[model samples]
Target: MDELAALTKLERVYRESSLLCFTETWLKQDIPDSVISLTGFTLVRADRSEVESGSSDHNLVNLLPVYTPVVKQQSPQGKEVMIWTEEASEQLRDCFNITDWDVLCSPHGEDVDSLIHCVTDYIHFCVENTVPSRTVWCFPNNKPWVTSELKALLNEKKRAFLSEDKEELRRVQRELKYNIRRCKASYKKKLEQGMEQNNIREVWRGLKHISGHGKSGDVLQVIGDQAWANELNLFFNRFDLARHRAPSSLPSRQAIHPQLSSFTPQLPAQHSALLPTVTVDQSTVDQSTSTPFRLTLDQVRRELKKTKARKATGPDNISSRLLRECADQLCEVVLFMFNLSLSLERVPALWKTSCVVPVPKISHPKELNHYRPIVLTSHLMKAMERIVLSYLRTQLVHL
Candidate 1:
């Protein structure tokens, strides 16, 4: 409704055009006709649930090309998407008033009351702004890797091919071949450099481009909420999208007990009863060898700094880049939320939700099981988990 209202404001743009199409209208039967009525155009759409009902309610965007007598454009394609790239990154920084820092250190102080005040303000700011977004539009790559000189030569070669000039065709073909070789070599060298730097994300991005999977697919055909939930459990109970691996080495008891697969070892009954006798020296506490007493601003900051900026976000729709950029101020809110949850022994309802994405793991996978699920959780929830993890780590020492 917001979009259609905005489009109505642009009467001149649509009035001048012959045909206008919306691929992702978010329209359903529940929406009243009055809601979608536009002055200068008719709307045609298909809902995901209605399209080929045998399949899951996914990828259901009805696409029709924007028609205009003014140009030869036809064939509507692609779903609506918010692509996180340099453009989106710049927009986030501008919207949040984040500045470039020489060091990505988090803000800290010993006073909890003061931290809570800062956090309350930050939460209000987020609620007012909502999540920063810019819809991505697919455009042809007019800027080719080939030089202008080579392009001119290619045009001449095209003229030769059309005019049946055999000698000119042969000469042009040789030059084109050399240019192609140079382009491939240059691209290959860049890929090698990314790999050598251990830039896994960069290397993976280049591979996606090489495999012709860089383009975004139909957004209208997106996975439904229920599907995302089931898939989240399937992926995240084990947490694959995180790519977190367990330690290979195991304690003697765990190694010998098959039931202890991924479970933490517990102290025997005799030892459990005597835990009160243990003593600790606060001055001798070493983070390198012991669990933290509580989550610190520094711990949250370290985790955010190490996290990838471009990965997908969860129910809150907060991007990793946004979290990392605002870490200095945001850590307070995160720490506060963690402490509140711990004290109350209850989590926010939103934290319980997730966004599950299906990624094709194998080529030409026909079975539903072939698709791998990648689960994304709320950034706030992750922070809460990290805090709990500190407690777990301390407790595990007894076993």
Candidate 2:
């Protein structure tokens, strides 16, 4: 206990441990609990001599707590049919004051831009009205195995501690410790039984807790790199050796004009002379001015089929599951919007808005280069792009 107190006074890097076993502690029966307590850890043992033979035991203490997990009761599972998306869509219609089928079939139903705006508004409504999940416990919570009996014993121990009743505190502390250890043993036994009966989930849950699956990573003790961040930064910055692009603003879309005709010696009015020259056939110009590829119902259906369910939404909080579920009816409307977007040669601003999440490549990543960006954009816009890309690939293959 004296050695443990001395060790606690010294600075240490990390202290969280799931299990700590103590061997020999030359502890006397007259020792007080207040002198041998660890603030944040649970006591597992003192010594065999003190408990069994009532003789003084002399050995060092190792402070460790082994947690045993028991099974948790759960409700039966059932199929969940969610209506948030449909309600959101209906809300969108109400916001636009449009009747059913009007926007999809009406000739004057604004363009893709208008449809995107309505969708974005609906997403906002859904997010604003949705309820957030609740947490059952806060940080520094008691262990799951702690019970009412243990809690009452703890209160008695506390009072004895506060009153400076050393002998009484030691007795109460010993009882409290014994009960907690017995409870943990029972919990561990229950887990072993569950495993023997093929309860995989319960077994895994207990194992994860025992292994400290969600605990914070221990910081590395390198001389300069700290927790791998410094070395990672050095490795990532080596690629910035030279500039790849000119340090000037560039045109967003530079016009490309294929040389229609190369100027050469024109046949002098009187002197008939023919010089070889490159020329553009009429067919080349016709292809350049050709309309944007028209999206078909089948193409829309194929794109919708590729949509994934229950994915994170983008700026427009609409879910992919919603589109995939009602693909048959929604494809016609989405296809009409897509065709209009193609003919007009413009993509809506809403379609361009994206949500970017930066994910770290390694533990304790520091620099911007250490993170990879994941951009989430409009699902509808992606579908339309897929169709255009498909058409372009077909043309390239023929070429």
Compared to the true structure, candidate 2 yields what TM-score?
A: 0.44
* TM-score against native, each model: 0.42, 0.44
Model 1 deviation from native, Cα RMSD in Å: 18.8
Q: After superposition on all CA atoms, what RMSD does each candidate show versus the true structure?
A: 18.8, 14.4
- For residues 192-306, what per-residue lDDT tens digits would candidate 2 score against the true structure? 9989999987888778667666533333212333555455444544565335434766533223323423333345755643555556565754785584567789889888878
Q: Model 1: per-residue lDDT, tens digit, 275-309?
A: 77757654445643464345678887776665667
Q: What TM-score, to 2 decimals, does candidate 1 have?
A: 0.42
lDDT of 2 at 21: 44
lDDT of each: 0.57, 0.61
